[model samples]
Target: MPRKRPGRVRTKNTNRREALKLSTMAPEDYNVRPGEVKSIACPNCRTWRRIMGETVLKIREHCISDKVADGEKHVTCPGSNQVVIIDIDVSHWQARQNRLLRDAMPQENRRAARQFYKPLPAPAAPVARIHAGVTLETARRAYLAHVEECVRCGTGQHCTRGGALAHRYVLVRKEELARRKAHKQSAPAARKALWDQRGGATVETANNQCRPRLDGAVSEYRGPQVPSKPLRVIA
Candidate 1:
């Protein structure tokens, strides 16, 4: 077999040396200065770029599969094709560092990265039970009425108390009104039925009275009446 190329052997030696150097390096050896935007080469595309502070820290804290926790300046390229864990303290000087890094980046890239991390507003307190015995229906109606009234007055939008009161009133009144109306309607129908039955019975009794007396009408009529007028001869 032909002798192994000297160049290939040398390249292999160089790679092995570099790997040894990296393995021997401690986490503290890569301390990043505050306000410095460290550029890292992408392992996949070999492109160089910088990352955000929050992203860098988060990755540094949780990216490693090994059990050893190395608090360092960790960063991954935007494409996530490469990750670097460096020993650095950039947390306290993040703002200044990010500003410089942002300035170095293209205007479009900088704008894309610029975002506000606004916290979401807290939820509102639940509506309190202002009035007892208020049914849901009544409460809902009251709430609607209050809204309507507010719209008319132009001051209702700001009236928290008014809305609550309205809801309560609607709930109670609606139930009561419904009950009263139902009673009124049903009561009349019942009374009318009773009156009709009574009238029917009275009419039946009157008809019975006109019939031949029960005690005297045992036999059929068998009588001839005397002539009131002389008979006319019309042969």
Candidate 2:
């Protein structure tokens, strides 16, 4: 596409109230970097306005108050249509701006532009927590239920969550089997202990039921009785 035609340059006859030198103004307020359209902030209104015309750039005419259209008094900005002379070195101004920007940036972000960036590793899949009372039946039901609801699992495959549930089910099943095996192994010892306790009670009951048949001495082995007072030694 053809480039835009350069507008008229500043002629000696182009009357203006005052002229603004680019060097005298703040570097930030005016931009005249090479290859970019020139723009500057209006001194009175402080709004950025495009520089019209080639060779001799003029700030686009604008009002002092933007609210002038809304039944407000119209006052033209003093900087409007003001002639801007490019007196400063554009390259030097750009370099200083670059330095200032680099200094203002956060310390962590300053990096070599050409360096290879290692792509971040993909995020890990989320899984449900196994609470205190998770059991084999409950785990299996959960896995099956997830498989039924998930669209991805309908094709005889597991999604991330479904896979996690299936894994939990298998783990719970293994744990339950191991627990059952342990309980089976311990049953004989528990039974023997219970039998011993019952046997002792039965023997005590039988002894209580039977009274001594011998007369006169009543030769039952009773424990000695406590004395009423302490024995006194003869002095």
Candidate 3:
């Protein structure tokens, strides 16, 4: 009626139908609102979109209540249909801003607050002590200096090399002495009979057989030597 202008013009009825179609579409089909969150469990994608209309309304309300700057954007929840208008205190917000500004600067340029940083103290020194008297040191040295020498070599080094030979000779001599003593203690008739059977070869062979066998069982199980009593000092 007012003068139809523009190409592909729609009649009044057609324009009304188009508007109705748009209105019938769900609010979610368009945009999201601040504070109002919507959750969808769709097979294709699971995501929430804010409704701009609702967001703008809630933001306006929050700005009035909190007296926040008009330039700040409102925050939105991404879960179910719920909205929350945040009204942060100006002073608290400023402190938070200051912290962020400080954090943005280089570490070397930042001021060190002693309240946040403390130096560790140095460790204490250790105690010392001294010992007196002749002690064990003096005693040990005197003992070594006056120790007995080897009888065979007449040297300070004890004779360990000729030990086996000396042991065998002592054993043989002891056995001979025992046999002679037994013969002397025997009755007159028994002694005469033993003397009648004695031979040089038999006596020598018997003495050799009586000596300990180096490879025998008794030698293998020999116990450690028992130490003799310490010699008394003449002084």
C-alpha lDDT of all candidate models, in order? 0.48, 0.78, 0.38
Judged by whole-model lDDT over C-alpha atoms, candidate 2 comes out at 0.78
Model 1, range 1-235, lDDT digits (tens) per residue?
5532211111111111111121233423333454454444333334443432332221111222222356554442233422344443456445555666778888766554468889999886545345666676767666666667675435645376565566566667877899989999999899879878879678768878756555643334543354447989999
Question: What lDDT tens digits, residue by residue, belong to model 3 across residues 152-234?
Answer: 53454434433433333455556667878887788777866776688746786877886666663444345345334686889
- Model 1: lDDT equals 0.48
Question: How many clashing pairs per prediction, in order?
Answer: 8, 0, 10
Q: Where does model 3 exceed 4 Å of error?
A: 1-152, 156-158, 187-235
lDDT of 2 by residue, 19-129 (tens): 888888888888777777778888877898888887667777778788987999987777777877888988999999889889999999999888998999977644445
Query: Which candidate has the top score in TM-score?
Result: 2
Worst 10 residues of 2 by lDDT: 215-224
| Model 2 root mean square deviation, Cα atoms | 15.2
TM-scores for all candidates: the values are: 0.21, 0.43, 0.16
Worst 10 residues of 3 by lDDT: 56-65
C-alpha positional error of residue 144 in candidate 2 after TM-score superposition, expressed in Å: 39
